[model samples]
Target: MWPQEVLALSRRWLLVTLRERLNLLFSVLQPAVWLVFFAGAMGGAVDSRVVGTGDYIAFAVPGVIAFTVVGNGVTAAMPLLFDKETGYLDKLLSMPIRRSSLIVSRFVFQTVMNAAQVLVILLVALALGVRPASGAAGMLVILVATGLLTLALTAAAMALACAVPSHGTFFAITGFASLPLLFMSNAFVPLSAMPGWMEAVARVNPLTHAIEAMRLLVLHGWSGGVPASLGVLVLAASLLLVLGSWQFARQTAERIA
Candidate 1:
């Protein structure tokens, strides 16, 4: 029953996203632009000695992949906000479906969308001569890391959506949060390149771990920290999912009250 409900809801959301052609185009395009322009422009300026590789494209690919997760995950809650405004969320809650289905379905849909975007980014990077050192296995690890990170972020977004009073506030908060997180992490630059304070902060950033795991896979194949990085992501995702589910139920209860 749970699986059926989740699948039905996920399918609906997926179709809605697909039908928005411009959204799909920009979703891929934003990251592609970063990969091409930002990476290209800055690649030359970066000292190859810092990253231990001459190819700045390769160094930056993991960061771009992480950026894709951040970009997609932060916006995952917009649909929920729209539904809330339209009262569709209330109507759905009135149905006999499991309450948890709402959150699960969103997570599933966002995970798929984020994965697709990441795949497109990787393919484009490959076309431009970037190859993962671990080959297919490395790519699989990247996808797994991406999935876990997206799940955590998507769940966080859903919780924010339920907590916030309006779509405008949600957008403002997410936008505020995303950029700092991106720049502070090792996504675009090595920790060695950052000042002491920023490096310390980046060390604690979850995105840093995820990006490092991916960098290790892409640049050096499997390594020691891969398991730890992935484990942290899985744990984070589980906790966030539970929190998001709780918030979702609370929101529904408030609607009924």
Candidate 2:
């Protein structure tokens, strides 16, 4: 019975997101523009040493994909915050069901939305000559990793939404937090190229593992040591979900009381 409520909540969120046709375009296009226009405009002159990969397109493609996922994942929290401020979330809590369902549904829908953007990015990458040697196996690994990483980020977003006072504050904080994670990561540049300190930071970034896992899928053939890459992402996401779920339930319960 509890499981059914969770499923229904998740389903309703999915439908609500689909109804917003413009969000569908804005999410995908924002990332695609960065992948195509920004990457193209600055392709030649900016050869940073961290970018060991000779082909500019190869260097940029994976990073673009990572950005798309993170961007979409974090922003998913906005709807919840928006609803609460609008009194919709309080109305939702009046129903006798597990609060976690309300949260899970948003995360589930977010992953779906991000997946749509990824498909477009991948097709554009193919058009630009970034081929995946892992073929079908590689793509499967990429999708699996992506799903995991996105969920993990979604948990962080949920936590942020719960704690923040306003949506603007949430947006500013999440954007500030996300941009650094992307920049300091091995996304655009090789770790070897960074100064010792920056390289060390990127080394520790969980996103680095996710990127390595993804690179193996698209660049290297599906390698044997996939677990290490996946473990970092899945572990981080699991911890965030646990922490966020606890906070969400506690906060919502107090509000209702």
Clash pairs, candidate 2, are 50-190
lDDT per residue for candidate 1 within 75-117, as digits (tens), equals 7888888999999999999999998898889888888887788
Each model's total of backbone clashes: 0, 1
Give lDDT per model, in order: 0.88, 0.79
Report RMSD (Å) for each prediction in the order shown.
1.4, 2.1
What would the TM-scores of all predictions be? Answer: 0.95, 0.90
Clashing residue pairs found in predicted model 1: none
Best by TM-score: 1
Minimum summed lDDT over a 10-residue window in model 2 is located at 45-54
What TM-score does structure 1 among the candidates reach? 0.95
CA lDDT, candidate 2, residue 150: 85
Across 89-194, the per-residue lDDT of candidate 2 in tens digits comes to 9988999887878987777777777777777777787888888878866776777777887887888888888888889999899878999998888787777778
